[model samples]
Target: AQSVAQPEDQVNVAEGNPLTVKCTYSVSGNPYLFWYVQYPNRGLQFLLKYITGDNLVKGSYGFEAEFNKSQTSFHLKKPSALVSDSALYFCAVRITGGFKTIFGAGTRLFVKA
Candidate 1:
């Protein structure tokens, strides 16, 4: 069974500072990594993904993620934080040919001005 984990319950950063939401995974084979952000009363929005190719994957809203095979990690990162970026973030993982995607509990990001 594939599983995703977000160790942090919440992350806080000052506006303009960098932010990161940690994610780790356990899978049988190669897996796809995804990051999604959910705003209050809004559906989860796709942020970025790591399918293959480069280790660094970039996605929407100025967000990017790094895929580390050895560490089994795909941590989301943003160089500059914005108050508007505050939201609940989720990390997901899916096997190469699997239909079901495992999602983390979610990490709330707080960008303070």
Candidate 2:
């Protein structure tokens, strides 16, 4: 079984400041982690993924995440946040060779100028 968790329901940050949305996972085998952003009335957009190779994975729109096997975490990060970056974010996990992807409840990000 594989599952993901976003502890915070909302994350608030000032524009131009760094932001992070925490995520942790539990899996029986190797896990595939992913980050996604959702705008109002829009579908979820792929931000980044961690499958293999580098522990630090960069994604679209200046976002990145680090895969930590020891901690069982994959937290999303942005060096500098923009007001436009404010949206609902989700952390997902899928076990190796699994067909289902489990997602967290989601965390709403508010980047204020």
> Pairing residues by index, what is the TM-score of model 2?
0.98
Q: How well is each residue in 1-113 modelled by candidate 1, as lDDT tens digits?
A: 78899999999999999999999999999999999999999999999999999999989989999999999999999999999999999999999988898999999999999
Q: Estimate each model's TM-score.
A: 0.98, 0.98
Model 1 lDDT at residue 97:
89
lDDT of 1 at 3: 85
How would you encode candidate 2's per-residue C-alpha lDDT over 1-113 as one tens digit per residue? Answer: 66788999999999999999999999999999999999999999999999999999999999999999999999999999999999999999999998899999999999999
Name the candidate that leads on lDDT.
2
**Least accurate 10 contiguous residues by lDDT in model 2:** 1-10
* lDDT (Cα atoms) of all candidates against the true structure: 0.95, 0.96
Could you tell me the lDDT of residue 64 within candidate 2? 97
